[model samples]
Target: MAEYKMTTPLTDEDVEKLKIGDIVYLSGTIYTARDAAHKRLVDLINEGKELPFDLKGSVIYFVGPTPPKPGEPIGSAGPTTSYRMDSYSPILIKHGQKGMIGKGKRSEEVKEACKKYKAVYFGATGGAGALIAKRIKKAEVIAYPELGPEAIRKLEVEDFPVTVVNDCYGGDLYEEGRKKWAKA
Candidate 1:
């Protein structure tokens, strides 16, 4: 129930304290990776090739942003639906990815991986592109630029707001939140 201020470096304790409905303004380093990047990463793993960056304790944001306006660090950046990358997530979780940022439902196996690995999934408000883009301080494409929107980019962010959709303990906000409205 604690309201965290913007720009806090969330610890394991801080992340663990967050629940489905709780809001947070995330800061610090986050890496962007989507379906194409994920596929490449997994392929690298299979080939025993080194990845572009260390996966440990990193947060992978599932986003493909629009081109930035003049002098802006990034453009309309927001989370995409998570289910598209469900098959790749469990592997990343097993490899030490601690947080995922996206929207919509995930597969049961991904949820199970979160429980087993002390990982979490966060949901950014869908369609809040302009508002979300303001939080990004800088953007650097680290891998797969050919994929364009699906490319992996490293972002330095400040006060990025999001809701806890899934936590390490098997709590799911979307499921519980929907049930309340569904019973109407």
Candidate 2:
């Protein structure tokens, strides 16, 4: 119901202020990790190995961008289906990850983790890869390069648009919106 402009490495306070359905324009550093990258990250955690990037206050974007063209910082970068990362998300949240950016419904465990860990789930426009790519100012493969487009990339974004799909207070926009329209 509100709009917020946030810069990443989001804090507990930052995520606490958000609610489902709120619009957000996120700027600053975010990491991209698709399913393959997530599995590796989780595997590292389980092995007690140091991760490629610090997890504290981190926001992970679930995307596997296409190869860039002539002069772009990134190619078409859109959110991947969120459920694919569900199995790994709670573990990441437990380690101080404060936000996630992706599309589609998440599992109950993910939602609970968001509430328990003061994290938030953000939804990016599903088919707006080209438009979203314009918001990414810089991108560099930080880990798992062999995974190709599924590699973990550190990204600097500016005013990247998103919506708060699930918030720390147990709000879920997908369910709320569906219930609101179900009777119409």
Please tell me which predicted candidate would have the highest lDDT against the true structure: 2
Q: Against the true structure, candidate 1 has what lDDT?
A: 0.86
Can you list the residue pairs that collide in candidate 1? none
What would the per-residue lDDT of candidate 2 be over residues 1-184, giving only the tens digit for each residue? 8999999889988998999999999999999999889999999999999999999999999999999997878999999999999999999999999999999999999999999999999999998999999999999998989999999999999999999999999899999999989975
* Segments of candidate 2 deviating more than 4 angstroms: none
Summarize candidate 1's per-residue lDDT along 11-129 as a digit string, tens digits.
Answer: 46666777777787888889999888999999988898999988877889999999888998889998999999999999988887888999999999999998888888999988998
C-alpha RMSD (angstroms) for model 1: 1.8
Against the hidden true structure, what lDDT does model 2 obtain?
Answer: 0.95
TM-score for each model: 0.93, 0.98
**Per-candidate local distance difference test:** 0.86, 0.95
| Top-TM-score structure, candidate number | 2
Pairs with steric clashes in candidate 2? none
Reference-based lDDT, residue 109, model 2: 99
